[model samples]
Target: MFKWIQGGISAVTGLAEPEYGESHFHSSTKRLTSKKVNPYTRAVVSAGDFDFQNPSNTNVETATFYINDLETGYCGFAQIIHSNIGITTTAQFTFKLYNNNKDLGFKQIWTSTKLENFEIVDKKNFKADNLTLQWNEDGSLRIKSEVNPESIVDLLFKPSITNGVKFGTDPNTYYGPSIEEQWGSMRHVYHPRCQVEGTVTNLTTGDVIEMTNEKTFGLYVMALQNMKPHHCAKEWRFAWFVNETESLVLMQFETPKSYGNSIVSQAIVTIDDDNETKVIACPCENDLKLLGQYKDEETGWSFAKSVDYTFNGYEIKDNNVDNEVITDDSKAITFELKGELSELIERMDVMNEIPQFVKNIVSGVTATKPFIYQYFSKDLTLSRSDVPESAFRGSAWIEVTYITDEREISE
Candidate 1:
């Protein structure tokens, strides 16, 4: 049977209205389905499907592309979000450009209409107005966006490991076991490691920043959430560490107490040596620990700067598992983050970025104070079981939804 946590503390509490329907917000158990290839990908074996449609008020889909160039100390992040809540829908695009001279340029453009312009031609292709995202037949991805006049990003993602990783209980299910499904459904897939190349052009300044493959690393993610954001998770932690020899991506989140205080964590580790690439997938959360948290003065949210985790690596077969564990103590996967809070790249009050109507809807439903903080770190060291110790010089991003903090709510 599909096991789910029983009620403890309701994340919704008095905020939820009866009109939203209790079936959409209650926890229930069901029989676990057998592992099979995702029906959405039965005809085409691309990176799953991008055409996720749900009429619920909390349905949301997003695509994010991030690149970090170690050689020139430049980084770029571009994302698009399509959120449909109740009778209204919103489409937003955002871009951030960090230059070699320590300059950060950011922009966000949105429209409540014109959502029809966003298209998913197939499981591997997507387009939004002037922005075009495509996964090539050879497994590379081309991402181009001109949604903002001030900043235009044209990038390419060439995976070191052509086959990306999928996180779910089985091929038929994409979200795995989490509180997201108990209340609603949230799922994610990622191309964890890639060689990135492209350019970020500033139209107003008529300047162009070239991103070459020399030392440019990237991570691509596609996510879907079918419930109100605040009701699904209370906090989130994400980071990517890339050096000359390896790339590591970590994602962890805490479900609201309504779901038994469960935590979901996943990691992808990629190593490149002598032109050979090895991708390790940690599909299960076993003995995972996130500790040592300090509150950020600016955001007023506690975040962990370190992590201790262990998982059984597996080689996926036929989009399912054969119950085989692929890692041992010597070659097992572990991650550690120790460093000074180097440079704060960006801190965003997410609610402020959305429309007031949507903000009211969120505030009316939950006491969520959502904030996102992005950082650049150069003082940390990363060590793994199979690779030599290396400096964890890269970027880290954190998102927190501070609930029930009167101070934050007042602010």
Candidate 2:
């Protein structure tokens, strides 16, 4: 169930709850569900009895470096390059940083975090001139060096403090819209070390293929680094929401604060073939039209009472062969996605524990909250893809949008 905790911030916990419920991080169990909880809690999530991460109780904040280049090579058209690092509330925040420039043919990815007595460096400035990195038997990384805290970047503080901040779908906490807009950039830029690990279950083969990638990107995108929920409406965004035969990719981005607050650039990407990657830059301009929206008493969730959306289609292109992204020259097609606002709100429900007294003060009964999500990309489209011949995966895409909806319950 969706629960928004109501309370003031806890000085000791650095964690806060909404006004009428418990902190999501405290009640977290497993799986990224809509069940209100901390986005960075170290809780084990399970569906049925299958545990997701081993020792599910162990809490570890995940960070990563990502580079989304719509252009295949040299003359890159759109470059969304950045890094992000985050850690949950834990004992010691000690980690070894690694470089990943050659591993992925793109940028840097972290190597390992098995260093001892190593110095913490500033963001973008690493003193690898005298440090030695080693790998451990358990596959964890280790470092050996006479650490110079002052010389090495103190990414957790000062010049590089944003690197250590957590960014994810954390309900109950108002991280602001900027947090959601820059979710991708912050994860890959600020933090010097990061990894991308996941499992790809081939629906056709029924064999689960596992993959773990440790890579780092050097550049930083401010949009990704400084994001948090409740920051502003400028960060709320959307895309055309694309779908294809081999794959589907939806691209959506939040617009920085502006007079016309609306999702400017947002779309999903899908790929059936390995080399093929489709990018949709602006969805709202292509297929997003607001018919009406409203809130209800029972569910207390606001929904698009009516929405008119469109999709600029994709087809294989001839020139894309050398790049092997598509079989034929890319063909753009346009389609529509029109439906009622109720369709988006059918799943919302009121929180029974929320006191009526508090609800009166904060009136948002059907707010989408700060969920920086695009379910049509590799990581997302892959996981949520239910095609009989396809599986699912996840990937981070930059989202920049402008939100200007006065009908919001919270407003």
Candidate 3:
């Protein structure tokens, strides 16, 4: 059943714009086509290819994608949600990305649609019921369930900053006179590790499971600090991903106006004998391969395959990489990552017609090096198994070895 009014509204408005503040928020609506649909109450959904589900709402009857970006010197994130059982209900989606820097904290907000307002959907003209979610990872994640029939109304929300606008770490906010002046670079390269905690409620079974898992990855960035005339001088572009069930995370980033770009990779696994901690460092030099790409309809944020991952003890099949022995046999867990880096500097240069002083920072810099890294299983599996179930509460830490033209890549 659907209806569309003359001033008929749409389910999703458009991608929200990023604004300055302490935090940013974004949201959008989608509908499922299948009748025997998977209940949103049990399943959590997210925009972007990165599927990090909040532990709080596990099983959902109906769900929406919410994102929040908190601004500190670094950044923190939170995902908020709501669900429905029978009647037409509404929920708000929110998330934040922030930097914790005391002097230059920054944030932004982006919302695709608005709430407190109704949109129209006429059954007769409504063409598609199936909501197709796109991802850089090649896998069919369809709605598979055995329960009631459901549909989506108008999905809308707004993105606004929390604490107004603030300069990012720099106090004297303004750009210099020249567009081609050379600015300095800021480096804070490290491996990112995370521990997540939440509760998942099974719609059919009516059971709740608390989830707390840790994932680690590498990170790269080029940063800028303190400007006389120009307030925001630093620009950074990077990539990273987190795999919890398997303890892995990686990233590569460089700020605009840097001497040379940088890449890093790292991993942590359970040790064997006494089962302590073992780390694998990033390779001095490597190559990246781009396998796929996609974009979110609501936020318009895009992601591209930047590298290929391969593990020594693991296997890659149909473009899918996974633990070979752990899944089939009781063999050692080993892994490797391979991938490519897309040239984003040219595109970034045009961002808001960047001021000359800002442009000076990234002058003559070129991205040439590709990063390669590997991880092998020792007693990691055995050690994780030994941890009491009580210790799996989702609080985790990550470490990374950084290497570039300047430093050796080692743990």
Candidate 4:
């Protein structure tokens, strides 16, 4: 759940004009569907897409790396979470390691008086405490940290798809009563299909694993969410599904009912090429549907038992120059994962993750119940429309979130 409400209240208290509330949002999808933007066009990707934004403009920013596979049978993610609240700026380095069975991890937080602990050297670099993330001159990403004793970070993410992906030319969604009265902004950029090199020690077992790019893969994400949680979104759904040669990823969030409860999502599908420069990254005109959901007792939120993801868009027919970007609308790509989720990894209470001050302030005003359901699996069936029924050993990490109830989500 997004904390958009807090930001809205903050702006009001600070005497900012053009109040943000019901009927204020201008959704990106609304723009995309207005006939002005062609949904079937190729995604406009760029090397500059990874640039870091000014921290003062947003409350939270993160550079996260998700390890898709490891020859030693371990996989997980590392994230440097930077947050600005009131007059304090804090950075949290968190990592979780998982295998085919169990999981382990650690998170360490460091706060600075005026962002003295965090440093931004340039477009491709930033340091939050002992963690250093930078892009190399050779189109690779280096993430190193000396923040702890239990887990050490020294990893290189070599992009199989060199250019970062921005779903559309605009690159951001503006929300408010109008463009001039913008109350919030949402942006995301993805670095997918990377060959990860280097090693990170196990969080608990203390075992050292040798790392190489040949058998490993991961995704890097740069995200900015600049509003109070509830005022921004009611739910968020994310999925990263991959095999050796391809991947399917979706990033989505829904505005609260006050903002029309609009759903905005981005989907990407990529096919591998041994030559890094030749890989194909496709941005889909997509829709994701949740099926057969039931109410959970603990969170009182619905859990989706099945998912159907449809990717409709053009693709590079082949490497041949004459092949052209083509699509068969009648046979748009589709995939579904049904039945039991492979593994119920974790159930998170969003309130537990926020600062006590913010918690106290929010608890006093409105009804806010936020929970996240996370699932992970090393082996899950991902079947394309035309294939060997199930063609590959796919790995996935998915999250579904539910926040306060203003209006019930029908689906």
Off by over 4 Å in 1: 1-57, 100-116, 168-183, 281-299, 302-323, 326-331, 355-365, 385-411
Query: What is the lDDT for 82 in model 1?
Result: 74
Q: Where in model 2 is the C-alpha error above 4 Å? A: 1-231, 234-244, 251-258, 268-284, 289-294, 298-301, 304-308, 312-332, 337-411
lDDT of each: 0.57, 0.26, 0.22, 0.64
Please give the distance, in angstroms, between residue 275's alpha carbon in candidate 4 and its true position after superposition: 5.1
Using lDDT, rank the candidates from best to worst. Answer: 4, 1, 2, 3
The per-candidate count of clashes, in order, stands at 2, 116, 84, 12
Clash tally for model 1: 2
* lDDT for position 47 in model 3: 21
lDDT of 1: 0.57
RMSD in order of candidates = 7.1, 18.5, 22.9, 5.6
Worst 10 residues of 1 by lDDT: 1-10
What pairs collide in candidate 1?
57-86, 180-184
Q: Candidate 3 on 1-411: residue-level lDDT in tens?
A: 122321121112111111222111100000111221111111111221123211121112112221111111122222222222123433332222222233552322212221332221221011112322222122212111111111121211111101111011111111222223422111121212222233323344443322332221111111112211111212222223322223333322321122122222222221112332222222212233435656524323334434344322221121111121123433333343333332221111121333554343222121111122211111111112223431111111111111122221111
TM-score of each: 0.74, 0.30, 0.26, 0.80
lDDT by residue (1-411, candidate 2, tens digit) is: 233232232111112223321111111111122332222211111111101111112122222222222112110001111211133222112222211123434321111223333222332222233453322233222222223332122111111111221112231121223433322121111211122233322233343323232221121111222322222232443322222222222333332222123232223333324533222211112444545545534433334444444544333232112112222444444534443322120131122233665434333432322322221122223222123534332222222232222346331
User: What TM-score, to 2 decimals, does candidate 3 have?
Assistant: 0.26
- Top candidate, metric lDDT: 4
- Please give, for residues 1-411, the per-residue lDDT of candidate 1 as tens digits: 111111211233223222232233322111111232111111122525333443455577778888778777776677777787655777777777664444454332222223347756664567778888887777787888787767677898887765556553332222224445444566666777788988888778787888875788888877776666655566766767777876767666655554444555666666675786665444344344445778878656765555444443443323233223333322334455445445565666777756787666556445566777666665455554444664445444423335434333221
- The better-scoring model by TM-score among 1 and 2 is 1
